[model samples]
Target: LVALPHANAQTDPLPSWNEGAAKKSITDFVARVTTQGGTDFVPVPERIATFDNDGTLWTEQPFYFQLAFAFDRVKATAPRHPEWKTTQPFKALLDNDMKGLAAAGEKGLLQIVAVTHAGMTTEEFARTVLDWTSTARHPRFHRPYTELVYQPMLELLTYLRANGFKTFVVSGGGVEFMRPWMEKVYGIPPEQVVGSSGVVKFQIGASGKPELMKLPKIEFVDDGSGKPVGINRFIGRRPIFAFGNSDGDLQMLQWTAAGEGARFAGLVHHTDAEREYAYDRSSKFGKLDKAWDEAVKRGWLVVDMKQDWKTVFPFEK
Candidate 1:
């Protein structure tokens, strides 16, 4: 009788990834770092991996998913705050005028975020995020936003974790926004999820119980240069691996690559317009221009969504 391949040997750690350079790079790096006595071997304590949330892990076309939630929150609370009807950015959003909203600019967008994401108890905010993620559907896919996460990415996260890597999401999105459902969705607990955050204050509720109330004031903006700062402040260790998908993540990637020893830095290049959105330099959200150039220059592994991923979303058959 002919010998067959072992059952474990036939199992693919990243089934959603196509057999190509991107997949090979990931597997090879993991193998090198995990192998005992190897020069590239990294200790379990130092096996930290950082990932970006928006375009790197999920779809971020048209706008960010957090921004979509903010817009929905504005609509839901509009009746109570009728003043929003006459307000510039809020009015533009209510009127569904993309041009007017764009004209309002970054400051206006921050205003929206401030209103929608704050002025509530931390528990209440988390509950609100959980509810929204459960019910809210993406406009294009008609599936829940959480379900829009890339299948290959999910596999990669799991594979990394299985190999003694501690993965953390260091994203530009709000920390509270991601922490609510990160454990359920990504197997990463809230504590491991770090992102941009607003200020909060301790207060006593009507029931005399203490609560942390979310404030409109920004505390930390964990994007671009802020990423390395946040990582240093919160994680307290230089990550051995980092993966991201925009100019916002350039600094984080740089920080990871700058660390001594064998490090892995990668980017997800959105190149599939057929299955997903295709964008790079000119996209309003998650622009991959500077980071793309940097990845090319530094010889970082850039996973082409069109060519490297066998599947885009988890819902895809």
Candidate 2:
């Protein structure tokens, strides 16, 4: 067992994380796994760590950030389609009626996504998302949505990488949506991002330029069981460490913990409402109920947002 870092250690890698069981657990796990002759020793080549994006890395309360992007796309493109002004979901969306949009539900949300997220070539869609993320601000925080990422988690990412861990983002958000800025924001590159995707096609444009066209149909949903399938398809290796915030990530965590050798699984519990938002079982976005119980039952580390994190967002520091 490697010695734990002192509370006032000058080289503390996770200063934003409170000195507690959660932080100690993470440090100890890394220390043990990295020790050359230790029973838990893991080779650098096998140091795979996967993280869920939304609430695990950043804020996902009120609604999902991608849904917000879809809504914004609808408004931006509404001028081209006059019918959307009178359509059920579009009208509700354009009207800025939260209740009306909620009532529209999954089908309605899908209609909005199909219109806004598809039809364009992958390059075109990438530019569109880039533009939107650059200017979009969170509704309540009023800061750019990118700035809403949890500070402690950012440090954790760096700390893991410093210890020779290869980090990968496995999110439920659109792969294209995240690929554009993930490297810039999270230190994880595009090739390492695995997420929900839509059908795309290879085609030659009118100008004879080869391109991939985005289709409006769903190809994969990288949530719940889909996460593991994506891991298998894209990563080709089992992750030894997994971090997530909701039940959707339960299967991923289970898969990680079940791996051979010393495995670690962690959950981020959103228990702070003042600094961030407080939510659990009943939350519409990033529901954390079943997974919370599962974490306890499985002896996984659960980081309480309010208690375990000394600072929530980067801006708070």
* TM-scores of all candidate predictions against the true structure: 0.96, 0.96
After TM-score superposition, the amount by which residue 27's alpha carbon in candidate 2 deviates from its true location, in angstroms, is 0.4
lDDT tens digits, residue span 1-317, model 2: 66566645558899999999999999999999999999999999899999999999988977899988998888888899899888899999989998999899999999888888899999999999889988988899998788889999999999999999999999999999999988989999999999999999999999999999999999999999999999999999999999999999999999999998899999998999899998889888999888899999989999988999999999876
**Candidate 2 local lDDT, residue 249:** 100
Weakest 10 consecutive residues of candidate 2 by summed lDDT: 1-10
Q: What value of lDDT does candidate 2 attain over all alpha carbons? A: 0.92
Please give the lDDT score for candidate 1.
Answer: 0.94
Which candidate comes out best when scored by lDDT? 1
What local distance difference test score does each model get? 0.94, 0.92
Q: Across residues 48-110, which tens digit of lDDT does each residue of candidate 1 receive?
A: 999999999989977899999999999889999999899989999999999999999999999
